[model samples]
Each structure stands twice: as structure tokens, then as C-alpha cells.
Target: MKSLRNLLLGAGILLLGSCNQAPVSAPAEPAPVDKAAIVLENIMTRASVRSFTAEPVSRETLQTIVRAGLQAPSAMNKQDWEVRVVDSQDKINAICDIMKKANPNAQDRFPDKNSFGNAAALIFIANEVSDQPGAFSAVDAALLAENIVLAAHAMDLGACIQAGPLRSMESAEAQAWLKSLGFSENYQPMLVIPIGHPDQEVTAGQRDASKAKFVE
Candidate 1:
């Protein structure tokens, strides 16, 4: 009976000791994300790419980039624009041919030889050519184009904003290709962005600080 009492007392002492122990501390929270700096860095570091690897950009990624572009602010929120993403090698080749054909009559259109950067895809931003649009369509489309290139840069993809395509798109030889977009007689091409995995690393051009002045 005495031995049994001793064992019971030891067990009780152990239980009390266990209860007296300090509680476990909770885990530290993860660091808050500094998205502002990241965005600023992206803007500051983004450079226009001239060449691209043969690796094809997935349609999903293109869609995501275009979706990001759609977030741009529009005049009166008209958002009257259409995006055509061309990733097909065959179609892309055809378009390249068309670009060359259209520029043939021009005074100085890459006179030596033609080069299209061999990009994985071309994203054409077209704004509606409406007589009475509720707001400024060109400005809205331009804003969206800015959003697109920035988003592509953020995703590690490179893009070049080419206004040169505007002339090509308006050429007679481009009618067939434009018709294929199903936007015949209504939309006008504003900008075409070629995007892909960058093969060439271009340095950012120097900014004219004098152009930007401190206002009182």
C-alpha cells in the first residue's frame, strides 16, 4: 500500500510539472509583400526587346497579358478596343510576308532586308473607327498598350511596341489579313506588339531629365 501511494504521488508530480510548463509560441507571420517597389522596379527596368528565342509563348500567358491590359483606364470607360493575338507559326509567317509586300512601295522601309524579330507572337491592338464614340478611343487604346508591355515585362516576357505595323496594316496588301480578323471596315490598328522569350538583352535608353521639370 505504501509503494502504491509513492507511485501515485510521482505520477501526480509529473502531471503538475507538465502543466506548469510554458505554452508553445505561435509561428511568426510571413513578411508583407512590397508590390509597389516591385512595380516601380519593373517600370524602371523594362527595355524594348529586338530579338526573341524560338520558344513559343503559351496562349494562356498571352490571354493573361491581354487581360491585364484590359484593366487600363478608358475615357468614359468606353474601352472600345479589340486585341488579336497571333501565335500560329503559319499565320505569323503569312503576316510577315504581307508586311514585306506592303512595304515594297515605300521610300525607306527597312530597305536592306526585312526583319520581324522572329517573335513568338504578335498582339495587335485595334480601336474602333466609330463616327461618334462616347469618348477618346485612341488614348484608351494607347493606355491599354502600355499596360500590355508592362505586364509582359513583369511576366519575364519581352515585348516591343511597334507603331510601324500601323502603316503595314493600312496597306492594300494587308486587306486580306485584316479581313481575317473579322474587324473589316470598323477597327483601325494602332499598335502591334511582338512578344516572346527575349534573345537579346537591350539596355534602357537614357531619359531626358530636362524634359521633366520640378513645378512649384
Candidate 2:
């Protein structure tokens, strides 16, 4: 019986070894590293532009940016976010007027006048208060907003994220503006981002590896 057991164990190991040595399908070869580097370089070159052409971003591109923003990480996988896109010249100008009045010296302080421009469209990122705790909601909004910025950049579009305009008012007009856009009671405006093609060239900033901290 002991001999028989030893023989069975030996046979099992041999079978396992044979299986391990058998040809196994491998994953598809990845794209060239240089291709990836070029793609990243293109994305990095994208920058915020205060001046934009008169052209408007197509609905498709706008949708793509919103979809990307929606893909951002959320607490507990609960993605409770809303985006309000302002494209009409009237609406854009109205908001711009409000911003201008809110900060008379805005252009002087922020010479970029980056808050709003000829950029064909604007987007407001909001989060539902009930979806998270006080600060958590803002954090979620921020993550999603960054996604919008990066995605826009990837598409060769320019984006500027601003918190100033939205914070100015709990004014009835402001509430009405948001409510008109179908924002639920829980959705609070967090930030506004303007989108467009850059009129002036934007330079990419170098990445500093030293800023990253890693733990083994």
C-alpha cells in the first residue's frame, strides 16, 4: 500500500509538470512603448486657454467630456454627479456678466480672464449633498472635474476650471439658474469649467518625479 501511494503521488506530480509545460495562450502584444509616449505627449501639450476661437465644440465632443467626467472615482462607487453645459451665447454672456460684476478687478488679478471666454461652451460640475458628507462631496466633484480637464486636453481642447463664479451667490437668481437646469435638491454646484480650442499656444510643464512618494 505504501508503494502504491508513492507511485500515485509521483504520477500526479508528473501530470502536473506536463500540464505546466503545455503551451498556453499568451495575452496580445501591447502597443509599442513609443506610441504610448507620443499619446501622452500629445495629452500633456494640452493647456488652458483664456482666448478661444469663435467656433463651438460639437455636441459629440461635449458629450465625450461629460462621459469622461462621469467616469471619475466616487466614494463607495456611488457616482452622484451632474454636469450642466452652457453653450448658448446668451447664457454664456449672462454668466460672464455675473462673474465680471462679482469681481471687478478679476481681469487685473487674474490677467488670464480665464474664467470665461469665446470658448464655445461651459460646464458646471455638481455633486449631491446626500451622496456624501460635507467635504466628501467637494472631493468627489474635484475628482470628476479633473477628469473633464484631462479628457478635454486629450481631445486637443482647452479647459479652465474655476470655483469663483459659483461661490459668489446663494442668490435666488443663482438657485433659479441651477434649478432651471434640473439639478436635484441634493446637487450643489461645485465648479464651472469653460471649454474651447486654445487661441494662444500653451506650453506643457515638466513632470517632477521627486514629488511622488512611494512605499515598498
Among all candidates shown, the one with the greatest lDDT: 1
The candidate 1 region of ten consecutive residues with least summed lDDT is 106-115
Worst 10 residues of 2 by lDDT: 106-115
- Alpha-carbon lDDT of model 1: 0.83
Off by over 4 Å in 2: 1-35, 108-115, 130-135, 170-172, 206-208
Q: What TM-score does each of the candidates earn?
A: 0.79, 0.71
Colliding pairs, model 1 = none
Q: Where does candidate 2 clash, by residue pair?
A: none
lDDT for model 2, please: 0.77
| 88: Cα error in model 1, Å | 0.5
User: lDDT (0-100) at residue 16 of candidate 1?
Assistant: 100
